[model samples]
Target: MSDTFDAYDDDGNRYAVPVRRSYINTSDLSGPGRIEGLPSFHLSGGGAVNRIDDQTFEIVATGKRLTVRA
Candidate 1:
């Protein structure tokens, strides 16, 4: 099963968001970097999961770094 927690940005500051992903299988929440309007996560096969909202994120990685709106 999975659980949810609060949301936070790169800084140690907390956000007003809820339902954060709580990994139970492993503890590897390493992210590549934050793009302007893209995701801050990087997959092994050049993929990313951009955070659109508190519970809405999309993949937009083409094996390369993407620069969206910070």
Candidate 2:
């Protein structure tokens, strides 16, 4: 995340700007998983909710990030 402002658009008409952009950190999870009984798991790739024993697992992520191994 990095940005600077001065592209003009208040009456100064320069509007061809692109700032504040920096993202490249993809590897949210790796192979090995058994979040049974809700030990510890909170995926941020957009979907992962598991609670074993009472049984409830809702894992959804097509935006990329899926690794589960038991």
Where in model 1 is the C-alpha error above 4 Å?
1-39, 44-46, 61-70
lDDT per residue as tens, model 2, 17-52? 122333444444684443223133334332343323
**Model 1 vs. true fold: TM:** 0.25
Tell me the lDDT of candidate 1. Answer: 0.37
Q: TM-score, each model?
A: 0.25, 0.19
Q: Which stretches of candidate 2 lie over 4 Å from their true place?
A: 13-18, 22-24, 28-70
Q: Model 1, 1-70: lDDT tens per residue? A: 2222333434343332222233333334784443233224433344444556555334464222222323
Candidate 2 local accuracy as lDDT?
A: 0.31
C-alpha positional error of residue 54 in candidate 1 after TM-score superposition, expressed in Å: 1.1
Deviation (Å) of 63 in candidate 1: 14
